[model samples]
Target: MQIRCNQVVCLFALVTALAFLSAACSGEAGSLAAFLTPEGRQPEPTQTLAPTLEGEPAAPAAGTAQAALQAAVEALQGTPTEETVAAAGGRFPATPTAPLLTEGPSVTVTPGSGRANAWVTVTGSGFPANVRVDVYLAGLVSASALAAAPRSYATTFTDRDGNYSMSFAMPSTWPDGTPIETGTLAVLVATEDFGFRANTSFDFVAETATPTQVPPATLTLTPNPTATPVPTAMPTAPRPTAIPPPAVNPYAEVTPLSGGRNAQVTLRGGGFPGHSVIHVYLGTFDAQVGGGERVRYGSAVTESNGNFTISFTLPATWPDGTPVAPGRLLILVATEDLSRQASAVFDYVVPTPTPALNPYAEVQPPSGSANTQVTIRGGGFPANTRVHLYLAGLVSVSAAEAAPTSYASTTTDSAGNYSLTFVMPRTWPDGEAIESGTLALLVATEDFRVRANATFDFVAPTPTAVSGQSWQGSYYANPDLRGDPVLVRADAEIHFYWGTGSPDPALPNDEFSVRWQRSLWFESGLYRFTVEVDDGVRLFVDGNLLLESWRRGERRVLSLDYPMQAGQHTVQLDYFEHAGDALIILNWHRLSDLAPPPTGTPGAPGLLFSNHPWNNQRGVNQTFCSGFESECNYAGCVRNYRLVWGPYCREGDYPYIRPGLYRVTFYGIGRVRAGATDYGSSRQLFSFGQHEFELPGSFTFCWPGRQSDGYGFETIAQSTGVYAAIDWITVEYLGEQCR
Candidate 1:
């Protein structure tokens, strides 16, 4: 019986296998048949069966391979299980199926063909969730526009389902550079992060094409059946309203706070009106419609979320071409309506400054007499340039340039330093003598901007008095000098200040007298004799009293000019002190050589009235027997013009004469009253002679000539009949007048 069962199984397997083979030959359930075949059993290759002039075998009945495999399995189930089938010589294997394919991001446009400026709707799916998806027109009609940066016309954000929809007009021309005509326009959509991307194309046709004839848009993914096709019109979706931004304040910030010109900076802003045009500028704000000095750097359209980021380069100048200075500046961002604004602060960097050059000069010896060689050293000038030098007083540059004292020019070395020498000049270029003890500046200059100066002190030589010109001094114990001198010595100069001390052990400080005598050889010049003493003092040049103050008085100075020939002359001075400080100073110096007047010219007579010698004041004249013979003028007896001792004659009332040295001459014989009390009280009667008197201001004097008649001389009131012929009295200026 088992044999019989195996036989039945074998018979059914054979028939079932034949059916599987026929199905496999028809390419139906071939994989299942192959799996059901026993292992290690090879199927014989099948031969093509020629048609019996009958139609080719009908195609296998239409059915799923799985369903056909299941029917085949049912047929084999009647035969045996897998193990049983294995025991009965049968095997089957299982294989895995691949996961189902999923579509990536894709985009499409309605109406495959469109005219320029025609609106089109865009649809997309399978992009990142809640991500910005930019839509751009690709395959520009113009080949040249293809190489430029991609420009987006429409933008949208994907929902959680990765779907988006937006509409925009077909660009009439390539937005960047060239024009678009009849050609294909590709639509590309991409996630902002580029994680997913898809593209499709549409036909861009001229306006001549009818909208009804346009074909449907080609898509990168399966087309949506629900999308309606326009027959006679290109229906554009309603333009999306601007997304209202959230109630948040607008704010902006930059990457770097400070930068120089041409520096690249990145800017970020938020909380702006959605889909609004935002402009960026650098300047202050103004209420005027034309705006202030604001310059636009760039513009941007905010996303639906009201946020944006942009990058730009800093400009070097303002809109008005003014250079941007260093300071804190504002970066202004505002909406198109200027209703919203945000600002960021930036610092314009300042450049480092260059150092300045200053030139200076110095001399070796800053002071000397004329013809002194001076070396000037300087630096900080332009290298290898010429430097002009000048010696100038406290004067302006132009004045110094016009009259420079010994200028020199030299070229500086490579180090912008120089050294040179110049002799100090006695006179300037204008022939003006450089006086003694003058201070001047030595100026060095390379150009108007480069100059330096050094001081040069010009001093003239001064004469010195030596011991070879000493005074023989004699000191007495009594002011009257009744006794011999108590001390005798040689004083280099007649200068002493005993104060409260005695001059010598034998002489007392007060009620003492001193005498100084010297024979000096003068140099044919007008000499000034200066005497300063306390109490009483007197000066005599060759026995002629030149200056006298022979009375107790305060220490005072008296000066007079004496004209002396180039020969030895006796100079004597006597001083007496009664009390208090004892002081005496006597000295003489040559003023200048005498320059007498020519024969017939009004010399520099400081004070001269008339030429007639007798028109002077002939005051209170008296006439008597006159023995002295001389020219006499109008007097008591105009016929003889003789004057006696009794109120003889008064000198003319001179006009207001300035203070100066003057010489009075008497041409008549007889003792003449030659003293002037207006000058000083050191008056005395003297014989006819010429004497110099240093008159003080407002001087008045009277001169009476007493003739030495051979009659009994008596007092002035009891006229002794002394007659003197008076001549014209003349006054000559002998020294510089003090105005």
Candidate 2:
């Protein structure tokens, strides 16, 4: 029986194994067999006959069955067979449909075992309608195996569009190890038959704060659907308004207070309205009252018209002990306004006592001769102050003063302006000529302590004359000598002539040869004589020749002792010349003799006497030499010979004097002796005589004249003369007796 049972078991095993193999092959062979058969065989019956095993090939035996089962599992495990997998679905080893979950859509948990609940929705494409999906807790899987099962929650239903969505929650029984922080919750989707899987993960975060009993402050977050809210509170105090002060007056005047008092200021301007204040200051000290230990005292208010007056009193104990002394005072005024303030300054002074009288004085008309007018002007004393003008080097005073004395006195006016004009005394001698001295005026008051003085220079004047005169022309009776008539006798007669010849061309012809004569009674003594003549002149005193200066325009002096017999003793002057102006003057005075008489028989009176009587006659005679004649040869001109020669003889001969008598026996004579060899061939030649004389006391003498070319002795050849001659013989006195 046991053998029979083992044989049954063995047979059942054989049958089951063969049915599995047949079923596996049946899927491949059914389509092939349908193609080979008549195509009328039904495929369902052939597939049913392929595999039949008891209870679907129950668990296999230990060794061999286990081996066979493993082979079958291996064949099913690695990759699905193409026929079976195709028969089951479409492909083998089914590809995953993504965005699937293999784990749960569980509640999130925190560290304190707190639970978090969420709802999930899933979407996919190319997934089956009734596909089974596995959901898992990603926390449940090891970190190393997370890629194998990435989905934490998943669902299987494809709602209307082949997409599946499911609600998930964290399990309450989960170990409190995996924190519910911000991470992905993976959801996997897979198929059961071919072991294909698909998955997706979504982010989740856990709350950082615990639940609180007190209500949170409310905060409203905007624009995000997931933002949380918070809360806060309110505030406290009041608002303030600004207040402006009064406007200042730019043109205000400050009045300084005296006697250590603060200044009072008045304001005048336009833009000040409403409530205002004013402040006063003294120097730099602003906060003092009327006495010591004081406080700020000047603040005040203004009226509506924008005008205010503020007064501040000073402290008795000042910082500088009363600044209003003599010339020193300073005060300052200021206005009190938060926006604008104005300031002004004031000063004051004190008086002093009068002084004593001043002492000073000055002088005028500094320096001049004595008797000069001097003036004195001064000041600085009482009215009617006595001013005494004094001389520095003289003794003159206001009355009968002596030499070197003071001279004048006066008084000052009410205005202290004084002036005095007085003549400097002539009798008051002040030093010498060109010497300097001072004329002082002294000023003094009644007290005599107030005294002053001033001094100036003094000088003298020069001298004068008695009687004098000057003369221009000759000393004779001519008008050129009288010269407009100085002091002279009334009947004085002056005589003048044109001289011997015609008037000189250089002189006026109206009075020539006219014998201009004037006579006067004479008083005689010494005289200054001047004579002007062209050729010669002789002057006589009492018919005695006194002086003869024969040259032209000569002057001399002489003293005559006239007898004073009263009647006129003739004073004659003889003048002779060819052609030129002639004049003579006789002047006399009774002067005492200041010199002695000359010695020896008085020298011959300066006069000339002529022996030729033809001198004064005008007509010409052949026997005489006329004044106009120029002689060439003498005796040949006949009995009384006078010959006139022409321009050539006048060019050669000049005049010489013999002073006294002369004679010419023959006018022209010459000689050539016979039988002399040199004379035998010679012609007759003319010669003239030659002689000279020196008289003793007798004045008469002769001169022998000669021509230019004449022999010693010869006969007269013709009657024509050589030049001119004068020949006469007489006896005359040649000494002082002639006068």
Top of the candidates by TM-score: 1
Output the lDDT of residue 79, model 2: 28
Compared with the true structure, all predictions reach lDDT values of 0.53, 0.34
Model 2 over residues 224-306: C-alpha lDDT tens digits? 58656666555542211111111222223344423333434343322234356654433221111122321234665656754
lDDT of 1 at 407: 61
Q: How well does candidate 1 match the true structure in TM-score terms?
A: 0.22
Instruction: Give lDDT for model 1.
Output: 0.53
- Per-prediction TM-score: 0.22, 0.19
Q: What is the TM-score (0 to 1) of candidate 2?
A: 0.19
Error at 379, model 1, angstroms: 91
Top lDDT model: 1
